[model samples]
Target: MQKFPAVLSVALLLAGCAMSSTQFDATREALRGSPPLRQQAIADCTANQARRSLQARQDAARVMNVSVRAMPRTICTRLVAGWSSGRLSYDDYRSAMVGSMTPNTVRIIQGR
Candidate 1:
């Protein structure tokens, strides 16, 4: 009875070590098998999408008498988030900028 706790503790420690080693080997094999070219392609696609989103927001701001440089963080965040999610249409984007602007604000940027 006195040795039971010590035996159980040793068993548990060995099991934990074995599990960790299995996980490490699996991780190493997965990394070795993955194609780095595929990872680079995915990264490039993500960056291109981000650039398109930013351009859309700037275009919207120009049409609405809104200053793109002076835009609130919330507006930019919403633009990117909504655009990426497809929650906001091109028309919706145009409407939001126009709707949010003050009536007296003259549109400095032409061609809405």
Candidate 2:
């Protein structure tokens, strides 16, 4: 029983490490449809990701018996700014999303 719990915890932790390539491919396909649509899609995707992260934080806090607080509003601001300024390519944005969580966020999620 102890070994099972340890193994399961490791699996879950690794699962959150990064996004899969398939996810990036799908995003790329969606972005390729129309030149004008790219901006809207990117904005929407970023917003969705932020919202999901907030929700996940809340859920983790509850599971860990910790107090829930608002996440920083600027979490996705840098990403959007970089994208808007052409400082970030689609590949860079995708990789950023996959590795978006900060060390603090990871610590909270792991209940450390």
Candidate 3:
């Protein structure tokens, strides 16, 4: 029974790590063609950032056992705009979106 729990934990962790790149690839594939479609996706994604931010905050709060403040409106706007204007690839845009929601991820990306 004890070994089973340890095995399950390791399996779950590895599963999560494996899915990370897969999710990114899937997003990129979905946005592969059609600049107009990509633009529309960026527009829609930008509009939804606020909600995503709020959800991220709530999730973090739950995990850290602390109260979380409301997410600000300006999160990820520049990156989304870059994607909207064709200045960023889909992968970069998706990374920015993820960074906007996760402070740790942003910090890591910023090398801070």
Better of 2 and 3 by lDDT: 2
Clashes per model (N, Cα, C within 3 A): 0, 0, 0
Model 1 steric clash pairs? none
lDDT of 2 by residue, 13-105 (tens): 212344455654444455455545555544543444344545554554454354444222222233333333444344443433443433433
TM-score of 3: 0.29
* Index of the highest-TM-score prediction: 3
What lDDT, from 0 to 1, does candidate 2 have? 0.38
Each model's lDDT comes to: 0.34, 0.38, 0.36
lDDT tens per residue, model 1, 1-112: 1111111122112112323434534433443355563243334433432344455546544444456543333233333333333443334323323333222111211211
Model 3 steric clash pairs: none
Best to worst by TM-score, what's the order? 3, 2, 1
Residue-level lDDT for 30 in candidate 2: 52
Q: Whose lDDT is higher: candidate 1's or candidate 3's?
A: 3
**Whole-model lDDT, model 3:** 0.36
> Candidate 1: misplaced stretches above 4 Å?
1-71, 97-112
